[model samples]
Each structure stands twice: as structure tokens, then as C-alpha cells.
Target: MRWLMLLFCLGLAACQPRPVKELPAVSASQSVAELYRLEREHHALSALADVTVTRQGKRWSVTQGVVIERPLRLRVDAINFLGQTLFQMGIDGPLLQAYVPAEKKFYTGMATLDNVQRFTGLPLALPDLVACLLYSLPPGVVESAQIIETAQGVDLVLAPGVRYETVFSSGRLSGFRYRIDDLTLYEVAFGPVSAELDFPRRIELDVPQSDTRVVIALDDIELNPVLSRQQFQLSLPATAEEVPLNEMEPVDDQTVEH
Candidate 1:
């Protein structure tokens, strides 16, 4: 299996955004507690959203009209640059399926309930994988975090390596900022945590190496809409070919989603 280190920002040191005014210093223990509460808050919500993924590359890059159903399914309706859905993935509990419409590719695999836990670093799963790309390690994400007043509302700045910073108001994750190495907010996911990630107003990815930037702006989103099993079922055309999991290229991102 040739697993491509899809986008691991491993070599870089700890990343930070331009810092704002400092708040009272929070003890590591308190930070951890706050982060845990936020995780619980995040997982409890369900939503449906339209997402766009942009990769700074020449051959293929931008993707739009991606859909995500909280705590499960993800559908890639279209991709730009490639100009088609290069891949689609869905998760129903532990069962995961990925489809490549362009290659007529289909795959089925087992995913543990704790897949996200074990895959805290650079592991991207269906549905939530997109979110992970924006911020790695959800449940145990915050080694330490502090609730501080930002220009907007309270923002949580997690300590340690990641350049992940989030803004929340009324317990909903309103905005987020993340970077890989020197990358400028390479990934961003936004929406009310009470609902699924359907309201991603903007998404951008800049790959300086490729000298390209991909941006996706979302205007409308639907949440928890009834969907048929067929929507998530990985049914391939009779002529569709099979792509083994071992054969499929791996997307490696040390920070989860680079």
C-alpha cells in the first residue's frame, strides 16, 4: 500500500496566530476541564452542511458542495479544479464507506467507535474527517484551554503544539482558526455546535509550496434533515471497479487535517 503522507505538517514547531490581549492565566488543570466540557458540547450536536475543500495545487485543487451529517455520514457532491467529486465518504456508526465517482471506485471498511480517539494525530475519518482537518484531536483536543474575552465572545486558545483557536458564544462554536507550520489558516470549520456543521460561511486552504489558494464560501445549510438509508449506502454501479483500501492513497496529515 502506498499511503501518501497526504498533508502532514510534522516538521514544523508549535504554531500560533497573531495573539491578542492576554487574560488571566489559567492553570493547566482548569484548561483541561474547560476543553473537556467543550468536547462534550461539540459531540452532542447534530447538523447537515455544505462544505468546500481547497488544495493549493495545479493538477487538481478545489472541491465544493461537500455535505456532512453530524456524528456520521459525509457526501462529496462536487469538487472544483478536479471539477468533479473525486471521492465521497459516509459513516453510519462504525461502518464506513468511501466512493470515488470519477474512478467508479467503491470501498467498505470497519471503523471503531473510538477511531477518532486512537487517530488523534493525522487520522482523518469520514464526515468528521473534514472537521479534523481544521483541528486535530477533538475529545482530548485541549491539553489546556482558557476562556478569554475576544473582540467577539469568549475564545478558547488551546496550549501545546497546535495553532488551533476557537471562538464561541452561547456555547456554540462560532469561528475557528488553525495553521500548519507556517501555513495561514490552512483549514477552517465554522457553525453552531448545537447543530451539525451546515453553516460553514467560509473555507480556505493555502498551499504556498504550490503557490495557490483555494477558498469556499457557503451560503446555505440544512441540518438533521431526514435522509434515506440509500443516501448513505455505498452502492456501486454493476460495472464499477473495486479499489482496495491498501491500494487507495493515504492522506497523511500529522495535525489531522493539514
Candidate 2:
């Protein structure tokens, strides 16, 4: 009888499930540079997007083409549904220029953050703009960082208020969220990875602060394509009046309500 009881206990133990091992916690000791390196890395890209801009309770929809080269070179063109060019803007490190055909005006100034904000209505510097568009972190000194591991993936809090959450699937970065002080600054969700480019075929950007959202349903996307310097150049008509970017009025409610 004792032997029978021992055999029954052994059979029960054999049928019991084994303990599941927990995944190792994500390391927080990664340096800022190392973390940035792990994020999206791209040299140059050209994309066409359907952009929707909302400001002061008004929304404007337009088709935009963007070409970007690393460090600080970008060109953007906005076109209306009528196939008319609304505006063309470019920045090459230091020089910034924009041509508004509707206003028949040309603007030029130093490619400073304030100037870029005045022209583009986006309060981001050249590098930040590029990073935002490319779904990556901007190149800057990170004051501090904290790593939070989640079932979805990991969230890296940088500096005082910026937090970047990277969603992982199959051990790959599938999406990202950029937040400032708990407010979502931007969110990007990528479509399937393209075999030719090894990047997402579609990318979406949502900016809540400015009430702006852009969906780049990439009909065609190229990575590191051969591009000429002239592609980043914009020429205005000789008769076009040049205006200073600083002199532009605020597009938000901060402007005087006359």
C-alpha cells in the first residue's frame, strides 16, 4: 500500500506542468548614445504624404512631398487638390527658404529654430524635425534616462519630460510614442516592412500639441537614393518679394484678437 501511494505521487508530479522562466528585465544602464543607435537609423529618404494641418479650429488637407538628407537638409512641397503648388520650402543646414505661390511671396532667413517655427508652424529645430519625421530620437545630450519594461515593449524616459516608448513585436521595433510631461507629443505606427527598403511601407505621425496629423501612405519610398544638391535648392522669381520669417504673425490664438 505504501509503495502504491508512492507510485501515484510520482505519476502526479510527472503530469504537472514545468515552471515558465520569466524574460530578463531590459537593461537601464544603456547610454543615451547606445539607445539612440538602437532606434531607427536612416540616412536619406523621400516620401509622399497626405498631410492634415489643424489650427485655430480649422483643418487644411494637402498632399505633400518630402525629401530629407541626414544632419540638416530637407525639402518639402505642398500641393492642393487642384494640382497647384501651394508652397515649397527647403533648409540646407544654415539657409532656409520658402516660396509661397499663392501669396506670390518668397521668404528667406537663417535656418534657426524660431525661423523654422515661423515658416512651418512646427516648433522644432532642423534635427528634431528630421527625427520626428523619421520616427527616431533627436540628436541631443540626454540629461537623464529611465527604462521601463512592459509586456508590449520598453519605454525610455529621457531628460526632464520626454519619454519614448518603443513597441516590440517579434523582437523588432514596431511602433513608437513620444510624450512630453504625460502629454503625447507624437505617435508613429508603421505598416509592414518592405523587402526592398527594409522599412515600413506606411508611417503615421500624430502631433497633438499642434493638432496636426500626417499619414504617409507611401505609394513609393526610396532609401538612400542618389540625390543632387540642387534637389535641396529653391529659386524664387526675380519679382517675388522677400519677407523676413520673424515678421510673420502667430498662427495661433496668441495673436491679438482684433
Candidate 3:
């Protein structure tokens, strides 16, 4: 019986995958209009704020400060709890120049700029993506919104490529579960986190298969404020290592290993 129990546990662990859920159905056109209207009413702005991202079962987490100056400039300063800066980047219009002050090293590359912009989860940029996430969107819409919902929330089986099972409400986002859309259990439960602002203040992502979880919270939002050009300037540390964005080669690994 003990051997059987151990086998069962192993089987379960091997069977688990990421989490993903889908919504029922809604008028995509109408939903888009509503989301756009919300942005206009809120008057989105370029600003900076503190961010914290946590994963499942881990007491240690990631804390960072993100600054956005608009049209296309983002600087993410990631640090540990000790107030030590881990990584910093100066993004000027799609260019990601990351520098490590302590290590005296830097790397330049192209990043998922569009993804970051679309999913700001903040009140920056003209068409806010977080607002869209709350509303119903067309599935396969814009090639990025993997899931869309018009009706009932969703239930997802765990599998590879699984996303989170999320239910958008008028309050804080919660019960965020992630698994493959095809494998999630037939039924799931969810509750609102808290609805203080138009955007999601808190989001809970659950991954039963991998036993992984993610919690995201947003605060200190400066909606639709004026920004100056100086904010986007790349203030590189003196004597720190530097690399040109074009110096790095493409990541096609089918060739020889450099």
C-alpha cells in the first residue's frame, strides 16, 4: 500500500501541466468598444510604480519598480528584498538595454515590448490591455489574447501550454487558476479579489498540476499624467560595461555554437 501511494503521487506529479481557461461567449465588438471607452474615461497616463510578483510555494519573491515614459520607453528596475538592485533596463523605443550595476555588466536585446505594452496591467499607454482583459474579447483576437470569454468563466485541465483560469469581475481579480484549456477539471470555483479601481488591483493564478501559483498586485497608479522627455533618457552608469543593441546575433541555434 505504501508503494502504491508513492506511485500514485508520482503519477499525479507527472500528469500535471500548466493551467488555462476560457470564457463562455459575448459580443466581441461590443466588448472592445466598452474597453476603449473605459480607457478614455480613465485618461491613462505614463508613470512609475512599485511591482511585486510571486510564484507558487516560494517564500522569496521578486520586487521591482517599473517606469514608463510613453510612446515607447520603459525602465524596469528589479531588486531583491534587501534593497539591492538585481537588474535594470533602459528601454528606448523597443530597444532593451539591461545593466547590472553591482556586476558591472550589461546586455542589449529585443524584448517582448508589445506584450509588455499590451498587458501593462497599468493605466499607461493609449489602449490599455488590462482593461481589455477585464472585458470580453474575441478569441484569437489580436494574436495575443489567447483566451476570450463572453459568458461563464471556465474550467481547464492541466497540460502543456496551459494558461490561467481567470474570472473578471467588478472587484479585485481572484481565483486565478492556470492549466491547459483542454484538461482543466469540468467545474471550478472563483471569487472576486476586491474592486477598488477600474483595473485589477490583485490577481490570483493557481496551477494545480504543477502546484505553482502567481499573485500580481498593482498600486500607486498615476493615470494620464504628463511626461517629460528627460525621463526616458538612458542614464548609463559611468565605467559600467556597455553593449550595442545590434552587436548581439540572432538566436537561431541551428547554426554553430558561439
What are the RMSD figures for all models against the true structure?
16.7, 5.6, 14.1
Rank by lDDT (best first) = 2, 1, 3
Ranking of all candidate structures by their TM-score, best first: 2, 3, 1
Model 1 agreement with the true structure over 1-258: per-residue lDDT tens digits: 223342334323235355787543444334435445554433321222233222333222233344444455544443435455555555566676666565576766655333331222212344435444222234334544544555433344554344555544444444455544455433344433424552335444443443434444454444335666566556766877865454544443321121
Q: Which ten residues in a row have the lowest lDDT in candidate 2?
A: 249-258
Q: TM-score for model 2?
A: 0.72
- The Cα RMSD in angstroms, rounded to one decimal, for candidate 2 relative to the true structure is 5.6
TM-score of 3: 0.49
Q: In model 1, where do residues sit more than 4 Å from their true spots?
A: 1-65, 79-88, 93-95, 109-144, 150-163, 167-174, 179-200, 205-214, 228-230, 250-258
Q: Ten residues in a row with the worst lDDT in model 3?
A: 249-258
**What number of clashing residue pairs does each candidate have, in the order they appear?**
5, 0, 21
Residues 1-258 of candidate 2: C-alpha lDDT, one tens digit per residue:
999999999999999999986552333333333346534357688888765545546655567788988778888887878878888889888898988876788988888876665545555678877765554556542334577766566667776787877666554456778788878877777777675766676666667767655545665677777877888888888878988776776545332110
Best by TM-score: 2
lDDT: the better of candidates 2 and 3: 2
- Superposed Cα deviation of residue 205, candidate 3 (Å): 6.1
Candidate 3: where is the Cα deviation over 4 Å? 1-30, 39-60, 69-72, 112-149, 153-197, 204-213, 244-258
Error of 2 at 68 (Å): 0.2
Report how far off residue 131 is in candidate 3 (Å).
7.9
Candidate lDDT scores, in order, read 0.44, 0.68, 0.43
